[model samples]
Target: MMKIGVIGISGGWSSEQLADAVEKKTGFRLIVDFENLLLDLDTGTVWSGGVDLSSLDALMVKKIGAQYSPALLDRLDILRFLQGKGVPVFSPPDRIMGVLNRLSCTITLRNGKIPMPPTIITENVDLGLKAVETYKEAVFKPMFSSKARGMEVISPGLGAREKIENFAKKHGMMYIQKKIDFGRQDLGIVFLGGRYLTTYARCARGDSWNTTIRSGGEYKPFDPSLELIALAQKAQSLFGLDFTCVDVAQTPDGPVVFEVSAFGGFRGIHMARGMNAADLYVTYIQEQLDKGLITY
Candidate 1:
């Protein structure tokens, strides 16, 4: 039997679902939490809950941390080290590293000519203020964030400067982007193995600025046009992740990408499309391992 481990947060919905799927397939279940992980450099061993992570036949990253933080980068470094030791990590740690930070993902997308909202990155309060003024309304995003957390929408008016300053104080580097009017919904276009898998929409409830689930958004099945799917495919292809979701918003001009997710949500796909993404993903991983496609 293959011993495959899922690196994720304990008690996390998606994490647990993935572990269950893996267990069903391989009869071995291990949910490796980064918080409980210990790496002994001298022995070149990664120990977590008395299990040697480097001994696993393959590893899948479901989630690195419970919340997004700079510390997640350090956790990924450990995964990279394991990969170097010949354990095939799904999606590869280096590829995930490229998309973990907002700035790095933005740079890659922009360079690929992917359509995105006008964005500005700076540590200067004055520049951030200017960006707010230029765009009229801007979204202040942390470099490391997910599900619209640590994000604030600031309109150009009274207290704009103070808002920018306060945000900059909290996050040394400010990522300001022109807030596009995406109506009440945005699309989560999923891709598995670099191919389009499915699409879902997060419909906003109440008057939230973003359509994240935490902000009272609900997931619904969506049928996207070919153009939209192509755009999302292009954006996700830039990262080459084994599994990912491209957040795209339809604007007056065209569709613009928000970001490529490092670990795509399984709940949304399940709730909206009635598909078992965890089962599908586990099957894909098994097929890859059987074909010798996943290699160190």
Candidate 2:
């Protein structure tokens, strides 16, 4: 049988259970819970988790959480090393920074002519303040963040400059967007294994500006038009994402993509579409193995 692994911390929830379920249903040998693995040089070979990690056929990254103790570089190098050895690794670690960093993602999007709201990226509080003055309102974001955490709205004469200074002092950079009035709602479309998986609408609850579950967002199923799918897929292709969720919002002109998430949770899609995205992911891996995409 083919072998695979999920390199992530067991969340004490369905992430682990889901891995087990996929193993049982797919008949693939799986190694779950490979986080915090020790990397050591054994006669010039790097071994992690007390085993040769490159032995696996393929690795599906369920989590790549930021590391401090082990150093993020160490974690990233592990994946690159595995891929270099011809073990198929989903979402190559090398490609991650370019896609995850807001500034880099924006550059790629614009270069690819992907439609999105105007953005101002800077370490300068003065530039951010000017952006708010010009655009009426701007949304400030950390270069690396998710779940809408640390997101701020810059309104004119509202001490926005002071806020940007404080933010820059901490994050050292900012990704600010001219807030597009999407009317409290946005669409999140999921793509898996280079295929469309599902789409849903996330609405902010009770006047909250953020449409994230962390910010009291609710989801419902929505069938997207071809134009929307094409747009999301275009973003996905630009990122070379094996799996992702594309966040899109509708402006007065048309739909504009705001973000493409590298690690997306599928609870909302499961709730609305009654589909287990986890299953599709495992199936995709099996199909790849069958096609000999994951080399030994």
Give the best candidate by lDDT. 1
* Candidate 2 structure quality by residue, lDDT tens digits, 10-31: 6634366446756876565344
- Cα RMSD to the true fold for all candidates: 0.9, 2.7
lDDT of 1 by residue, 2-69 (tens): 99999998899999999999999899999999878999999999998899999999999999987888
What is the lDDT, from 0 to 100, of the residue 244 in candidate 2?
83
lDDT of 2: 0.75
User: How high a TM-score does candidate 2 get?
Assistant: 0.90
Query: Which residue runs does candidate 1 get wrong by more than 4 Å?
Result: none
lDDT of each: 0.93, 0.75
Model 1 TM:
0.98
Q: Each prediction's TM-score against the native?
A: 0.98, 0.90
